[model samples]
Target: MSEHHTLYAAFAERIDAVLSALELEGALPPGTSRANVSVEPPRDPSHGDLATNAAMVLAKPAATNPRSLAEKIVEHLSRDPLIESAQIAGPGFINLRLARSTWTDELAAIAALGGDYGKSAMGEGRRVNIEYVSANPTGPMHMGHCRGAVVGDALASLLEFAGHAVTREYYVNDAGGQVDTLARSVHLRYREALGEDVGAIPDGFYPGAYLVPVGEAAAQEFGDRYRSAPEAEWLPVFRAFAVERMMAIIRADLQLLGIAHDVFSSEAALQAAGKPEAAEAWLRAHDLVYDGVLEAPKGKEPPDDWEATELPLFRSTRFGDDQDRPIRKSDGKWTYFGADLAYHMQKAESADELIDIWGADHAGTVKRIKAAVAALSEGQGEPIPFDVKLVQMVQLLRNGEPAKMSKRSGNFVTIADMVDEVGKDVVRFSMLTRKPEAQMDFDFAKVVEESKDNPVFYVQYAHARIRSILRKGADENFAPSAEHLGLLGEDDLALVKRAAQFPREVEMAARTREPHRIAFYLADLAAELHAFWNLGNADQQKRFIVAQDANLSGARLFLAAQIGQVIRNGLALLGVEAVEEL
Candidate 1:
């Protein structure tokens, strides 16, 4: 979508042009749509550089068979100067092999673009709000919350690269039962700070040692002010103090993994501002919410205390949810979903798109929120697109065995612990190796290993190796440039083809909102660099640093530099550093 067009986009445009010309000649139907037509790299590289199903998609409307239509399209495409050859394959696909000059041109473009090589204007500056790692401020973030943080962060980076004005956000569940418990625990520590006989933390209170510091800090700040006060007099003050302290801990923990949210929206702030009340009133006017609900949820045993109390419920069933969701509990308290919807409603007013990253355990909640967005659009005029990505759990492993709790946080393995065990780059890259929806194991032993199975090390090693080769070339007065890029041969062209795919890969991944694809791509690029390096081990002529041939050395070194730059860019999106040394 950028002003600087990539080869993939160019080819797609050319195919569209060909179809437009066919329409002019009445060879194809006048109103044939080409929106679904796509020109992409062939599944098998040996078949061709690119393939398109344009012929097949248009053949039905043209009143012609796919084979004959493909032949006609190929006739026009073969005349293109950039295309070496065009042939019909399968039932209707048109395969194209681009001239070698095209690959060289793309490499030159990569050189000109540098860090911005794979960037695109696909997002068109639309505002995107991405909320991730909304972990309750009850405790420090553990591996339970790490995947969502990494995924959301990477996705925000990816969208920005693809030209979106993205805001990375976190929701503070300060007005929750969990935070109240956190306050109670802090109070115990606060009492202990006053040298009281608060012997041991009860079973319900948080006993993590991390809060000891918070208690000490609170006691030093306010001496015995709440020691004898009633719950009404002290709860609010203590809750405010504790939530701030808990957030500080959460922010520091997120920083260990290179995450810092752009905004931290508070549930307490929303409630205090009467946002939920306003949302409920608006929904009532639209008939989206009503006083209803008495049926027990299926598959769950009814609690003995359960009563058929009429409560206010959202008409989520009108959309995709299985049943109406209660917005207010029987006790007249707003449900978590109701408050969350108000938070999302806040998001809708400012952004063109809304994306929430949540744990897979919250999968049942996706539909209701989506319904809320739809209902909001119905009441309002404009639409705000919303999507929720669920990240599954990460099982911690050490030496091929399940790793246990963190000594630092007490309850679970904290993100800080993982970063301490194996640096941030390893933690970030390893978390992204799998798609968010699929469960994965973070094997500390394997992640740090120097082998192909270890993507973090393997990919970084490639960049480091390339840097070494470039340094050697630097000593020999060999410089890479577009002027010497023409020395590349068949295998060299293959490498360029792979490099050129970076832009297309970035665009596709951004379109799908899948940043994991970027990690997979970097791994493949690393493999190519390593495989090409191995060729140097067996043959001296294939070496990047050749004292006998300065021209060849410059060309090969140029290719290496481009590969390294791309690796750096891809790793940057995943919030991992591209190390020059392992």
Candidate 2:
């Protein structure tokens, strides 16, 4: 109830009370701000339970000695009921130890909350749009897009769990040059399907045979209708057919990984009929549209046909970007950036906060999107903010060798192939085991290896062991008694302490917009659970399913059940299956 009031909160509240009492909210000492206060568990448990640097931050501003100010703050915090003691430590840092019963009460609260132990209301129902895995409509999703897909889906789930109203979106680049190439490739396959001698695909076109079915379907649907038609006469029909089929394939691939988008915004539809002038109008209204000639190439000479011309540009540099970006080409064709600006503008109308999940190749594009948002919200009292997260590449390896790329998918590993080789649970969990910003190596052999080194299996095994303990307890007629909890020992206390920290961890991960934090936390929690179980192996009295002592077994069984439930809930949010019988 009321978020269970984490023990660290009291330490933070005490620091805030001291600041308020001193009336020092304006600014802060050099290189630090008064609002930079943070209370976290000490890295070294020997130091203390929690540590803070409020005194160090306020030292110069308050014109007091660092250690002396820390001593005063320690004294003020020692008066709190939750704190057992507060000590002034290294360089004016205050380390606090909480009463043992505080953790005991936290365990009881976690048991009461059950599956909802770590749920928070921090989001306050704010709407957040998460656009991710908007892969090109040319083919199925590959391994490169897997990590971002998992991260975006898990982050969206984490936000929802933390009380945010989130919209999951997928942007389709159907109107781009790639999709146009897709149409021509399908036409080649269409002729082959019609029994024509279209041997091997020529260079500069898609050589993947995955489009064979698409071509066959088109030929069957419109027999001889577009066989002799000009490219212009059939481009529209073929492009629509090819894109729709590719999208179906992509959707199926996402389904294999348990990901679904709430909306699939198309670049074609954004400017299809009457929306082309919309983006230009908005740009002109914001004065971001300008006609300028870009400098010619420095390292290599341009083609003889290349000519200098003035083009419309968006002043992205005003929003902390490196330089201005072009919105249109000299041939009067809208560049990719122009379509993206319109897409984001359309997204802002529906959601106040917009977040894009893109590959590292789009790192240079981040500033322009932010600049467009600022320009669009220039005069409005309420402005919509956008954030773009660039996910680095994932190199898939197997048996210490680079995995062979499938030519059917055009030099990439499809998500379907990945999930088929590795189960959905392993693929989803392993992908998110690290931060999305970090470049990850997905070693197929190690992921399937059954050991602690494999986080997915380790966590699943922990849940399975918990279930086995409960089943054994049931066979021994061990049901938790109200009076049995008094038997909780030192090992039990340690387990409960880690369990009680779940809510605080969830809040931190959600606030930081990082779902990998959950993955890492679950790994730690699993280790603690496994360690606690191994302790039982060395000592008969510590066993959770003691045949001789039903009362002791009852208390331990309840704790084990609680652990299994928490692990299940957390893994579910990450889109990883939690098996009770693995």
Candidate 3:
């Protein structure tokens, strides 16, 4: 792979070198921490191309005033051929204006690197296990799981682009009561398949017609053997069969949205292997677990049936949980927390880092699970970085009102149905238009609208328009050439500057674990491209294709091609298609 040196990264190195030279010259103290020094675009673009706080950050440690230090730094910085000028702004900040050749060189780099333009090495190949859309294997995926699914998948891609070895995973909750209920529901359908009336699905049972096929499949394979057996004999058989069939359905739904997990861990299988028991034994030896009685429930109206019972408890409160949590119930079965802790420990064994994407309803459980991982890390003598990102619910709407539910999933709109209606690109991109912690509405009518108001459309349209311009140039016998790139002026470099931000944006987004930043950046870049294209409307000489001047037109075409490549690269990270034509 070719190494990509982004404009921002290149300049950051230059600033660091300048600082190092200052230290050697005895103008500053030795071994001063540069951790806080940063290079970024000036908030006001009119100030300069790039801004850094190296002087301000190092001033106190060097025993000098910031302005005095900045002047010394700028003296060395001004000597670099790539730097046109360096000036000290307000107390200590340094702003730099790059030589025009610098941007032209970056544009040349963009052309040479093509799709690899914004790729970074920030992650340095660490293994990251990201679990998302682990909705119970109960039914088809619904809108409730849609946001986190897209967010997690996009983050995984962003990390990979930033040079991380990422594993996409899904946790199957097949051991819980939900799967047991699913088994009972499928049993009713099995009876119906075997010619029983099986009237309306009773309360507490799944009512979706999607399970009818699972029941028919079961009836075909098992005949009438377990059909008439006791609940004990049939529950296990039906549960396994139902879970397998439901997982197939979930996989199909995820595939429709361009998502596939590298691993699907089963809770039942984890229990069968006694992983939870091993986790409990280790925690007990480490004093992280003990036998205790939990206090009665605390509330404005406490439960009348609340009772205290001795159980194996985890010392979660020591790590910031409101109270210690129970690892097992009075009946000897592991509680959900016990199983989840074991699952995370299993994940930590192989991965350098762990991330879980869950719904907002799971927010209350975050602290305990984090405490478990912290305890496990303490026992192993190595810290395991764990983060749980909660995605707020998305309300599905048609036009302006709440959308109708799918008959297939019973109460919620299935992911398959949404993708079928709007498209995979629209569904995936719409899910990431807002921050995951903030609630959002997915309006069917608004998302599919073909206008600037729709972000996906706006960005895709930009790529499409660039292709159209290239095609027109080809038809007019004009080929894009870097030979006359010097013919391009300031208005054109503004677009180059916007496109150049992609690498910096990618690194920042990956560091923050927010893929939406890529989407936001692409939207702004598209706006810049569109604005630049509009300049041709008022003045014939400003148009991308100047019939009288092929050299200028060729240079402009080359610029447009590189901008299109950036749009494609950003959309690829979000898993959205960049259409060549509308």
Candidate 4:
């Protein structure tokens, strides 16, 4: 095991020993496991440094006052060489103050590990699949899809960094009603381009001018032959042409934001092209396929002509869904869920874990989809691990006023449009500064501002400042020899200590499947370095790369260089850029 892991284990053992002693003395309840006990720094540095709730949890069961139990635990804990003091605080919490040497050791560990300081083995080589930006091929991707794309991409990067085998996937919704609308839109444009006055787009048909070029392409390829062709004669050609074009555009937009998928599973191919009869075979084998009539959905109704007809149903309710869902519509065509089920089943062939990133609007659809996968994997060894994360909407603003809907797109703001306004680095980092489930506001005016509130600029400035110091040190013949690292002073040691926590942050984010932790960690580390720098400004002797003291200056420069490496590594996991001299 790594030294950091060993240190944590030792710390955990000490806590367990204290818990055991309390139990043996009849000071606490039996069967209380110390495995969940945690030792972390207190929010207030003056409140005895580190605190634990162990005594508070054991008080009532031990028939003793919490503070009394805390006092006993502290008496037992103060013997450790690493701890300088221990005390009982408010509500019987045990607070600990570690000797300064402990923090100094942490700094040394950071220097030793360099960029690999925070790596963890929590994942144990498990495989995970992350699917995101599964937008339909009907049009260009908009701002609504941007947040999820960034979140999913960064999350996948975080997972991989934490040692999980991750596959990034994009589900293409090309076989459904939406794509048909796109095809029809392109057909109209095609006819329009062929000198036919198609007039304004027909009702139920897409009217966006984006399709005009698609229509023109078709006209140039077929030479007006499709103008008078039957709907069936040209529908396939139109559908193929439009979906391919739309996917191309979507790919370009994702690239603009620095995202690329490892797999692009096409719904159309899953349905009719590859592995024909796959969905039907799996459904029948599981007894999930049946003929039944669904109750008319409440608060909504299909056309009056929509009659209750016997159609294939999937017994989704068996797995906690509210209602059994339809696999085939009344028209004998596969429902969207049918295609989705087949796609997930295909996923099982290559992955052991599956995660889908969706919009909050799909909250109502989570259960049935999970149920289908559960049923498919029922008796085939272990159940496949499936999870869905919903990315909430993004509200944009400029100059404290809500930005008008994207002016050029004439619809929702496109991801490409946002990338054009602000570079990809700012967009990626700012979007991930908050949890994916929380609604976030991205202010165009503030992200580029040169202040602490703008994390992108703050982090980049820290890196640039570090570079300047190193260059100055090099020019003055202050060589950063490994010998200097041992003499790191308090402020320099504290900065390295903070930088060493990057691996831990990566592990936490990946194990919880939350990438926002990386953004928060980088910001906090930057703040720590900035604080250390400000302190130096007041004390000329302590300034980084002090020209008169070569040994001390070289050691501090090494610490700062390590800090820059950590910042770059952390930002890279979030898919954000790290500039050396911004």
> 1-582, model 2: which lDDT tens digit per residue?
345555566557777876665555433333445677778888887786788988887888768877987876776687888788899887898888877777667666767777677888888888999999999988888988898899999999999888789999999999878888889999888888888888779887888768989999999999978876899988888999999999999999999999999999888989775454687777787778877876665558887876788888888878887777888777777789888887877788777688888899888878877888767655444778778888989988998789988767768888888898989999999988888889888988999999998998999999998988877777767875435677788788778767766778888888888988988988999999999889889988888877798788887887787777778778978998788687
Residue pairs in candidate 4 whose N, alpha carbon or C atoms collide under 3 angstroms:
118-503
lDDT of 4 by residue, 175-255 (tens): 888888888889889889988899877888876666787788888988888888899999999999999988988999999
* Candidate that scores best on TM-score: 3
**RMSD of every prediction:** 1.6, 3.4, 1.1, 3.7
Rank candidates, TM-score, best first: 3, 1, 2, 4
- Which of 2 and 4 is ahead in lDDT? 2
lDDT of 1 by residue, 1-582 (tens): 335676889989988888888899889988788887988999999999999999888888899999999988999998999999999998999999999899988887887788898999989999999999999988898999999999999999999999999999999999888878888889889989888988877999998998998889889988999887787787777889999998999999999999999999999999999989999999999899989755865557887776688988999989878889988887777899999888888888888899999999999999999989878855667768899999999888889899989886887998888889898889999989999899899888999999998888888999999888888788878887567777887877888899899988889999999999999999998898888888889988878877798888888888888888889889998999887765
After TM-score superposition, what is the CA distance of residue 206 in candidate 2 from its true location, in Å? 2.2
Which is the leading candidate under lDDT? 3
Error of 2 at 10 (Å): 5.6
**Ranking 1 against 3 by lDDT, winner:** 3
Model with the higher lDDT, candidate 1 or 2: 1
- Candidate 2: segments with Cα more than 4 A from true spot: 1-7, 10-34, 58-80, 273-276, 300-303, 320-322, 407-410, 480-483
Alpha-carbon lDDT of model 1: 0.88
Alpha carbon lDDT at 215, candidate 3? 92
Supply candidate 1's per-residue lDDT for 353. Answer: 91
lDDT of 4: 0.81
* C-alpha lDDT of candidate 2 relative to the true structure: 0.82
